[model samples]
Target: MSSNGSVVPRVTTRTLQKMRDNDDPITMLTAYDYPMARLLDQAGVDVLLVGDSMGMVVQGHDTTLPVTMDQMIYHAEMVGRATDRAMVVVDLPFPEGQIGIERSIEAGVRVLKDTRCHAVKLEGGAEQADRIAAMVTAGIPVMAHVGLRPQNIHVDGGYRLQRDTDRLVADARAAEQAGAFAVLIECVPSSVAAAITDAVKVPTIGIGAGSAVSGQVLVTHDILGLTTGYTPKFTRNFAEIGKAIGQAAADYVAQVKSGGFPSKSESFS
Candidate 1:
């Protein structure tokens, strides 16, 4: 049973589709490590995405550009092992969808076989139709991304809100028609996100895209305020965990300085 006293079944791509049909809101979060993945899975998140955002969240990098496939697989393996109920989907870091179908197939197959993840998410749209179709044909479950692709950051010049409704809707449709199990709409207007949701038969997960979609997702570190410094405007820090951690460290320092840390109960003797 889940913490809510209900049965927690293993989440699947089809499960997300069913939730969309039933008007049930889906929940997804990015988790790169085993401990956090376990906690989030136990908390009943529907999906745990091992996002390339780890380059920024874990590696202290300025962009996700430097993240490699090997790094992704390593983190994904950890997240996949820790998850029991949540469907774990790892991102195909930059160039996975940009390249040809043959290499993409190799990458997708490797991720599933090596990490034991349920699915792979690639950033792209209509242009990636053949790749998405081919990956699905290879027995790889694909989650397609549309609107404000992060891999295109250098091309886009920065992280800007995507507002092209017709294009976004077309991308979502193409991904669904190409056999993507779900479409993730990111950093777009709520109306556009909703249109994409309406346009596609599959489930639409959103990040900066708003609540009108079938589900929502956020960088876990950003949500818990564990990520120091700037976060996206669309993100909300549900708890000041970083502050608490800092306070805990400060308290320990104070205790040690005051000679009160080695109390009889705490001492080895």
Candidate 2:
């Protein structure tokens, strides 16, 4: 039973596979709350990702690893309630939930059942391929993330672009073999991203991984021009809504101070 008194219809795994087979581009946006999810759905977004990136976007954390499964479930459930269209894919945050295949499966199933999401996403490639395989075998759909894995920030010393084209290619293949429906390529070279997309059977969604991949995913704040901090160079600002909002607020203040607001035209009879 869904919280909204409506049937929770799942975005089927077969629909995702069909998108891959048809070469249709997959569109995903990171949405943390119900209103954002509802707006994204109205805008015709194909996927609503309840990304653990929420730690940074919503909780003011420096990394995503600190987000717990309970938090993830709560956020996912929130987005699920507001989403009537578009598939919701929730993230499996670092360290806390992804201990092993069993742990991942247990966590993933809980997220799907509790939040009514279509799938779950995790960071890693070949090193986590076995876990991906296990999830698939357990009937859970998985989206594998490679390249700039935020969960590895502590070990990698920070967010750095991955080189090693050969290793990258191998990792992508491993992900495909592990039955990932799609793989997210982040902060890798365009040539490498293109090669990986071609080498794998599933689709590749790129984020600063260059244009050669099959699809694109961007953080909603960065794309909408609402984020407070510095955005990546690859981020293209479509509408500086943050500045617009500030200007609008300033105008309202001035209007009220000058008795320009609630004019005769706006005054109630």
Residue 94 CA error for candidate 2 (Å)?
1.5
CA lDDT, candidate 1, residue 180: 97
Estimate the TM-score for candidate 2. 0.87
**Could you give candidate 1's per-residue lDDT for residues 81-162 as a string of tens digits?**
9977999999999887687898889889989899979899989899998899999999999999999988999999999999
> Top model by TM-score, which number?
1
Q: Which segments of candidate 1 are over 4 A away from where they belong?
A: 1-8
TM-score of 1: 0.95
Model 1: ten consecutive residues of lowest lDDT: 1-10
Q: Which residue pairs in model 2 clash with each other?
A: none
Report the number of the highest-lDDT candidate: 1
Clashes of each: 0, 0
Model 2 per-residue lDDT at 15 = 64
